[model samples]
Target: MDLIGHVRCFVAVAEERHFGRAAARLGMAQPPLSQRMQRLERELGVRLFDRSSRQVTITRSGALLLEEARALLDRSEEFLACATRIKDGQSGLLRAALPSGLARETVAAILADLHQHHPSVELELEELSTTDQLARLASHDLEVGLIHHPCDVAGLELGPVLRCELGVLLPRASLLAARDEVPLASLTGLGLVLFPRADAPAVYDDLLTTCARNGYTPDSLRHGQGDSFVHGLILSVNAVAFSPPDRGTAAGSPSSEVVWRPLAGAPLAWRYSVAWPHGRKDTAIHAFADAVPRALWNTAAVSTDPPPRPLHLRPASEYWL
Candidate 1:
């Protein structure tokens, strides 16, 4: 019955104290406004107004309910305003994720940036591998993700691509550490310490293929997930791990007994971008996307340039002719 709307009509007519004047104020004809007031009165089982040919006066009952009616309309307006803010992404809980293997400092910086810009938004962050992120994003369980390249992005909208060049991380005692840069071919006899294939299948395959093409096939592939674990493998197993450049201290340094050196030709690079489900980008998602590049650049020293080639291509296996 649009009871609130009837109350609005009643309030206007009561305050104006004349049917024609109230109708003019409400931008409606006098007949309809009067009819609505009568309906409102019947619905409430109370006579709300005393109407004569020329004048209108509010009944005692109408005066008694007027303040309550005003309060209800005020609350309704407030409710709609709040819903609009949520729809616009100005306030809400945003579920987001980041791939593992990111430096702790990088993650902290990203969180700080998001908070500074979106103080009203509550970001629920998760640490997930690229493979797990893809599955959750597909199922609509995640709202946004920062994902590595060479992964399937079939139904997602991606942000600007950023690249961090990969270097060799080896025991500083190794002979190869003496070189200004290590060529892939130089590490032929060493095992390759890497994350598991399941972490990111396409990236894993691509890394192996590039290494093989460059004449450095590892003696074995060792899997490790944490920095300490991966570093432990490199030191104990006489192997090398590919890593991003660090400032001579954090990523296996003088005290850590490991060192990071650039590749001779920069054969491998990590590319990543913030992504969300197609058609689901909102204000909060955009805020997160906007914060990522700056955070990566400031903390991880990543380059914001677009990669030379596309990140992924659908496998030909799906074709049926």
Candidate 2:
């Protein structure tokens, strides 16, 4: 019977008090509109209007049904609005995890842009390591992750690696600090602070392979568990640690005791990427992916050389950034 359509026809007739006027308002012929109202009354088993040759008037049953009919139309509109919002990634929450190792400014820029673009997307952020981000993401605890490694997890996929060149951070009082740029081989026998290989195997191994490739191998490797501890280790006057050049200077200030020097003839890098669970399609995920800027894809500011092995990339063209 197209129940809602019939009810709307009846409501129009009741309001207009004339079938001719109601049909004109509904943009339909008077005969078809009259038939629709008659069909609605038959379905409800009640007379909805008192029809006379002069005018039309609503019955008690029609008055009672009109209030419910209006509420139903309002609810239908509200439902459509909510469904459209979900499809467009406009009104849901996205739980995203980021690594503590990402350049602070890099993280800040990404977050700021996300807020501006997807303001309705409630962001619940967590600072996790790359390994932890992958695990939590797999379990569905997180919708998106900004991780620095493990780009090849079984259930995860990503776009081009966000690569950043590595530089040596040292005490300003040390001999190595005097150089504008330090060669990879020059730090071979010095006390070097590094991430424990067990913490991030692929990333840590890549750095080691870079050192060995340049004909230099650290004689002393102080495996620091965290960046704060590693930075403190490098501050001890002898130990040197690798970091991205603009890392600590993101706020435009360098530490008085620490000086940063670029690595010569080397391609030490921090390779990171945006990753998510495979086959998990969600609008918030799509919005987050698109919000990330194109500039972040290449953080390799100092080195013209490539990684020992090219980073694996899966282009995200279908997502429409």
Candidate 3:
């Protein structure tokens, strides 16, 4: 047996204090493990395990060897992980774009997970609107997109669709802010702040359609881009805006200026998906996609067959707005 394998067997037996348990842990038979340990002790010219009818105990030399073996195993694991990260085509950069107004913890959590799994992967993140993300993805300029659902771009597959319900972000002074839940119709007379209809049609259309379906429509929606900007309008003005639910607005200890209230009557839910272009089959893209947790998402994939003919797709011109 190699030195590492011998050391592994010794460490497992020492820790388990039973040859049977150590063999089970190692997925080996008892006889081979016992033989391996004996060989290791003979090679070292010192006894490691003191065995009797009832029990097995580590000797003085075994205790000290245990510490060194564990350290060596840990270093070996790190070395193997380093090789895996940089060996395959995974050792490159992944350029990603994310839309604003996502749940506060979304980006940080994803980045943290990616770092842990693939330390060699370098990430470049951009805060582009869903529209821009679609455009860049089509041209192969961007590798991954954390975007809103209902993305209509061709040649890209959507996946791990996450459900994010919406809440009303209202100023503290508004009458509706005092209620635990705000009725959909309560927003009828209030000013509404929205992303430009073109930027995120899925979100914009869904917001308007849900409101209209429930017998209430905003008289006029002032177009704005960016979650922070829309939120600013809500905070400083007597306006209502769509916000992701449960992010310190609706719960106890509401913010000083803005309060979150769930939209009652019609279910207000939005979806998010991690998008990547099809047929590219890039390792880094798949790695990033795999790193995202599946707990909160329902994945969907479009076909890999290329579109038949050349067709014009929408350019992300509104990205600057």
Indicate which candidate wins on TM-score: 1
Question: Candidate 2: misplaced stretches above 4 Å?
Answer: 1-72, 196-199, 223-228, 250-255, 280-283, 295-321
lDDT by residue for model 1 (152-239), tens:
8899999999988889998989999889899999998899888887988887877787788798888888898778888899889989
Full-model lDDT, candidate 1: 0.84
Q: Which residue segments of model 1 deviate by more than 4 Å?
A: 42-64, 246-249, 305-308, 314-321
**Clashing pairs for predicted structure model 1, backbone only:** none
TM-score of each: 0.84, 0.71, 0.61
lDDT of 2 by residue, 36-102 (tens): 8878778889998899899888889888988888788778778889878776667667788766656
Which residue runs of candidate 3 sit more than 4 Å off their true CA positions? Answer: 1-88, 225-228, 235-237, 246-255, 294-321
What's the lDDT for residue 313 in model 1? 47
The residue pairs in collision within model 2 are none
Per-residue lDDT of candidate 3, residues 183-277 (tens digit):
88777767788777677766666557667667567765687756567767776655787766545343325445676777885366656667888
| Alpha-carbon shift of residue 56 in model 1 (angstroms) | 4.4
